[model samples]
Target: MDTKDNHSLPSDDTTRLADTNSPTTANPAETTGSTTDPASTTSPTYTGITEEFNTEDIQVVQVGSVLKNRFVLEEMLGRGGMGVVYKAQDMRKVEAMDRDPYIAVKVLSKDFQANPDSFIALQRETKKAQQLAHPNIVTVYDFDRDGPNVFMTMELLQGEPLDHLIRRIRPSALPAQEALSIIEQMSRALAYAHSENIVHSDFKPGNVFLTSKNVVKVVDFGIARAAKDSDRVVEDATIFDPGSLGALTPTYASCEMLEYGTPDPRDDVYGLAVVAYELLAGSHPFSRKPATYARDLGMKAERPKEISKEVWQAISHGLEFERDKRTINATQFLQEMSGPRSGRDSRFPSWAYPVTAAAGLLMAVALVTLMFFGNGDGQPEIVLEETSSLAEEQRTRIEDLLEVAEVHGLVGRYIEPSGSSAYDAYQQVLALHENNKQAWEGLHSLGDQMVVAIQKLLDDGKQDQAEILIARGLEKLPQHEGLQALRESF
Candidate 1:
């Protein structure tokens, strides 16, 4: 949103190709391999070019060049700003096991090799990515070097960047469900990374790989900074700095990130929102030049008339320019996009209400009669005894409900409207003993507790759990305005 000298690069047709392994204008033949010790190496080799190359000189990798005496370079995959990506075979596996094992190897450019600090930073962050194990994220296997050439091995994804797909469907928004499916997977990946204290400072469609098998794999996890670091000097850069590389695409970066160079979990959330907005609206949210804040654009994203209001609301919230006002994390964003539950059309039939009312009146009369006359043994002892037995049964039922309510409070589970929860148990208690003060108080307390629990679950992106709690709360306390409001908010 904000324009700053620190912006990674200006938004252009080439910005999408700036990521690691992304197709770039750099010629593949310009890349050359150098070696670094695997054990002492400390940085990323983002730009594949080395100092050995003059402005007009180009060195091409041989087809059979071996890396670390393990991976054999096969062919160049694609070149990007950082380096040239090559399809390499795991020679150990291929020779020992007689099996073909191909991996994507990104050879650092020479400029990165010349800058030790930037190289070490890239190496450190790439190594950090090794700790993440998620199906939706491209896997980084190892970081090593051949001569002075720095390279990292990772899973070779067979798919196209999401940007290609978006372009193919230009002038038409992707189906809502299809877009949601992709966003959900990305959100899950981000949630996991955030849990590990890793932020994908740079997120865009180009970094999202949609496999032929319908799998979504987010690539270039920590590579954004690697690319940025190789090109610029970061005065006080940390491992987690979004601007550590001094390169952030303004189109996807948050206003605060651009203006202050502070990176947070919210920055990634903002990027995800922009990508999702493009998927749904088939265009950027704003048409004017980039501003310090998205709000400065003074425009709202054009909502696709075909999308449901719930979905549009969720997208709009994610696109908030204010960091604090935006969705706090990926989990919250996912929950909002999930939409509200399609709960039962009706809690009970109209006929059942009338029948229940009639039954209640009959029970009330019977209870009154038993209380007044059941204790007299001389006046129809048999009727008195029968009334006494019924009273005992009612008392036992109330006791059971009370016990269940206590258990439900202890362990939070099956918390649906019709499910077994403290709220439902208390409702049952009140049904039998309308004036039971303990039951009424328990119901009220449970209501309060549920409100907090439901909100938390919603924040954590556990929509199903939140829905269950809300449904059960409403079922138990149909007259609860708080519960009703919670449901409507979804």
Candidate 2:
């Protein structure tokens, strides 16, 4: 059977004396408190320095009461640019004909709320999004302002974001086959938006949400734009213009999309192509350095064959430098994607070699299921012999979990217990097979953990102790993700 809490806790040697009132979930919560309020009048920085733990810092805003009886804000789900996303109950028409009563409340930043210029951009885009209705799209229920606060109420989705999925299935580079599936849905989403004349300016993986059923939905229409000019923020010459929304993701933006001009719907296709290429290549097609820094650069798209030739044609077409030369739309690319020569073949020819190689890259993961618990070392209690059938079953289970971890890691949740455990499981496999790529990947997941741990220690006024423990861990594994990040700071 698969064990849930088989790993032991940290030894007493490493334990810090945590206070009873110390915050459990939100570490350094102050640092992330006012993510959008640009005005200096906002609350003090929750930098985890002076205030270790306080109830005021984490006050829950009453949704219905605060925003003029529109919706009652409950627990916070997550935070992002513009405002925080909260689980809210809609009291808009509760006394009328009966209806399901909850919705997502997206609160805008105070500074932006005060700025008529910025606030109007949010208002225009949300109004346009409210007009859209699709099963694959997150429905915008209504838009309203509460006194000085602005918020958009919409359907609350209950699954991980596509960004989450990408993190879970992080490939050093993705298989062309897998990459094709992601791009297909993304194309459909873009096509739907284009038909509605609403451009999803930010079309990165983070915008996609995935349900338990593998159903995908494109979300976050906060910065979406209309076919014509609703350039409210641009009038003020703001540092960022949400209404003149074009590609915000530099990693995936096309050359045309990046230049100074109004973006067309085709820009979305170009961005999608870049995403598809990254999924297969396990890296961005464009270099971070400016074109001037690298003299040999050209207008051609990076060859998919660099990762998988089978995907090269789709990549090349999607990333064509000239808008007219590029694939006309997502539908055209979808057709090409369905063909036999695409990355769908069971056995690829030499041209398909690279992506095929990625498929076989096993991340050996071992499940150490022992009979003891309460030990501080955190080592697996159970260690079956290498040849036993029970050991094989455990190994299989761990491998499956590792696959999920790989996907989740890429999506940005790799440091969670589930994510790190997958890495721990792979390390056990590495004990048996030294050069396993998956094992190394599991090791890579530790980067986030080490950083979090170090930050906590610093916040607790134990900088010297934090450095010492971090140094010891790094000396043992030089390439470990956690240590590499720390090294960069020094």
Best by TM-score: 1
User: How far is 95's C-alpha from truth in model 1 (Å)?
Assistant: 2.1
Candidate 2 deviates by what RMSD? 19.4
Each model's TM-score? Answer: 0.58, 0.51
Evaluated against the true structure, the overall lDDT of model 1 is 0.60
Worst 10 residues of 2 by lDDT: 26-35
lDDT (0 to 1) per candidate: 0.60, 0.49
Give me the displacement of residue 449 in model 2, in angstroms.
47
Error of 1 at 386 (Å): 48
Best lDDT among the predictions, by candidate number = 1
